[model samples]
Target: MIISAIALSLLLFAAGAPAECLGEWSPHVVWHVAKIGKLTSELQLGPNGLLYALCGNKLIAVDENGNKLWESDLPDGSKSGCPVFDARGSIFIPGNALIQEVKLNGSKGWSFKVYQGSSKAAALLTTGPGNLLYMQLPTGLYAVDTAGHYKWMITQWDQVYNASTQLETDWEILASVGNDQAVFVIIGKKKEGYTLMAFGEGGKIRWRYSLGEIKQANLVVGGNGRVYATVNPKRTDDYYKGTVYAFESDGDGSPLWSYAMGCVDLTAPTPSEDGLLYFCADEKLYALNQDDGTEAWYEPLPKAISRPSVDENNMRYYLGTEDKRLLALNTEGRLDWNLTLDGKVSMRPMVGPDGYLYVVTEAGSIYKIKDEAPESDGG
Candidate 1:
């Protein structure tokens, strides 16, 4: 597992390093403090670099430099959950069996309740031509207005799950995947199978694809307006190989293409801005044409490495390994650079708005790697 110094230099460059940070290398570079401790549940960066996190039954807000701003606990008898911020700066958090909206200034906006249980996740969607679409995962899929007024609740798709599993124990809730204009919902039991339902802004089902099995992968939509999903066959005594299905947005049960990955596909694949979809198979990163599921490029890495992270603008791919080294590659599958860390890296490297590479480790350390000093011709 020894990484050469020359290899480390190339990896750093390929990882979207600025010009000033290249050349002469420091054995180990450490940055200032960002945040300590594992995030309680989920962490999201809000508008203007506001960091919001769900810590147990409380919602904590902090500045970019790890300075505490304020923490608001859920109402009297409520428990705190993950919060999602919409495009309009409204914060959505689940409390008291309802999904409540709060402004950034700590003022109550609106609240929506459900008879089944608390909300799992929520997103504010703005459809084409300035239409507002709100989605929440609770008892079922809800379509609502900005003011917390219920426009419609989808009961056509039957969903029922155990009250103890937080919506994943069994197939009790229908999940929505995609942005404002397009959403896909999977409904039905695990053993009995399920169906993929596509919908528009107004609670209309555009199309439905019979999956015939249970799928747990997050729904990914490409720029070409197609839905990419994976299905896993756990039981049912059938030896159906795991496959990734690509379906057109406007069609009815017509699979544009299907690719057999293996026994299962575990990760959610993201389509890059350059019309290339990236997914990890057999400990290697594979880039496929977003237009059609065809291999564009791939790079082999150690089996202990984590998933790949791509910079759509810089056209670089990054992967970290358990050997305390980070690998980088260009869009054409060329090695760029590799860097050694103080310890094993767990969290994914976050590219900040200020063009700094923020890599956080499992041992509670955030390294801000910046360009050391730009070289000059003695001018």
Candidate 2:
């Protein structure tokens, strides 16, 4: 795709956006890292900037040039959630029957079953506040220390703390940043009720808000001192309804604001750097005002969004789709540009530590991409 370079320059200056994010960022592959030729959709860029993936029970780390760093053998059924990194730079995997760890150098670290006498693998694992690992199992979310020891269980959220209040596996966890860094979670049971909880200091509950009965919910820590929560109130046959809410990351009481819409809507919610909450529902992408939950704009989507790219700048939003397309929506909520990939998007497009958009495909390809405004000079 070719565009007038002179006009592009003017657009860049008028918008006051960075060079890379000016307008119509035409995506071109900078390099190819791996081409395993098989579907390796589950890939994660580690803290050290290396791409990590699980092909079967073997965890492999690869560099930018497709060079293999190291491969470690994981226990059988070690595939589910992506690999998570701890503060000490160790990797954790949700194995079928255990919470496994891989050291920084690709060597096996600590491996232990989250729940004894059970073969059910963890549904999700994330590095939470206080340098602890939070694992979602059938019984509830369990906090595990770096040394592979079970620290605590948030099984029954109710104060009664008995068998009757058990909430099961309906919960999601995320950690906030800044001076008052903390952990937040959405936990509850079907029909009974659902609520959001914030943990601070020594894992003690700091605040809670009742959310009625929700089928699913997603929480995310935004750039500022805000926490965003989106929920699917109920699935009404062919249609679904959701409500997006925002809360002060550290303050108490009800949500700062709530907007009806955003949930199948079970995917993790995403917020842009400049304070806009992105929600994909009913085949449309809606951008909401972060402060007041007001609707800014929305664009029709070819398909439901998979994972969203929270670009460093507010100029553009990159979204992965099940339809094998990399979509770029401008601040005005228009699908101005798109790039076709070799296969369906496997992982969310992420801006690596080095500032390049890293996109992984189901065809086992890692693409390092740069977005440049279209130019008159054709490629």
Candidate 3:
């Protein structure tokens, strides 16, 4: 998918007005992180610090300095999927009924149709395990090659297709659930009503769980082989409850533990190397023990929470919040330091490979915050 690069420097220069207004706030924002394009989904920083965003029907890739490298547009009328980079620098996008492969140079390689037009973003998963696995629209799971060719498609849940049941796969397993049956029990409002299905490597049904009507986000597989998810349900006359649930990663589908909170959405779980999974729920951030789902520590913030970023040394966690604050917290969940911004933080604060914290706001502002050396008193 190699394509010749055409210079759009003039267009970029013209669109640079938003970047200029970034620091209407401070001298603290040392660098103006440019918004190369409007992102429909959250932007992910590659290991090389390159920024990748899923903007509407296009995939935009930019350098660390925010220089646009390439932008690949999707087919008109086709739903957009999240951008995921495979090992070969190829991009995998599952949209509508098709899984498309994109080259690093912003060219289309090939595509495989996994579903008709029922594919949902929640059904797709990407991870490293010597193989690439993906979920099909409607109800199926498949693994394909770097070239967009299908390896296998699992139809074990074909019988549940008429029931609106959903399926997902991650790390190296698959899970499915029908709309009517009980798979896993969800105790409260936040804990209730979502169907989960788990499968093993060979397309075997490993486990099934039911959540009673709660919206689950950041479903991830932990190191100990447990599936962790954040649950949030719509507000009702009853008190709203938000929770994180951990299930046995192996196909047994048993519950490990659940933590409750107020109305909040948890960004995907950020599991630390020390066996702790970090999550942001409601206005609080928590680090929990993955083994039995016990709270190791938690930090209540001045505002609603955003996704967290771990420091280079893993000793600190960085998060932005609705109250327009950027904070760094120590491992103990104590505030290490914090800075205030003029605008709200709806985007996840990105910690670039260069050690700079990149933040963007709904007001179209981008700021790069870095640690300044301690000031010394004049002798």
Cα lDDT of all candidates, in order? 0.55, 0.64, 0.57
Model 1 error, position 81 (Å): 9.5
Can you write out model 2's per-residue Cα lDDT over 1-379, one digit (the tens) per residue? 1111132221111121112232555665666554543423356777787777776677777676555666677775564556777668888887664688887678787886644234343446666666777665545556788988878776654556645643444433221222245666665666566778776645667788887767777777777868887777775443345777888867884899987653446355678767677767666777887879988887787764665766665466777777777777766777766777767773568777666677777766666676655672323
Misplaced by over 4 Å in model 1 are 1-37, 40-43, 55-58, 74-83, 94-97, 105-109, 117-138, 158-170, 173-175, 235-239, 263-265, 303-307, 320-326, 334-349, 358-379
The 10-residue segment of model 3 with minimum total lDDT is 178-187
TM-score quality measure for candidate 3: 0.74
Whichever of 1 and 3 has more lDDT, that candidate is 3
Task: Write down the worst ten-residue block by lDDT for model 2.
Answer: 9-18
Clashing pairs in 1: 8-338, 10-336, 10-337, 11-337, 11-338, 12-337, 21-371, 160-172, 161-172
The clash numbers for all candidates, in the given order, read 9, 1, 17
Q: Which stretches of candidate 2 lie over 4 Å from their true place?
A: 1-24, 32-42, 116-123, 149-155, 163-181, 191-193, 237-240, 374-379
Per-residue lDDT, model 2, residue 205, is 74
Best prediction by lDDT: 2
Model 1 lDDT on a 0 to 1 scale: 0.55
lDDT tens string, model 1, 229-276?
756555324456555678887777678877665545334566678877
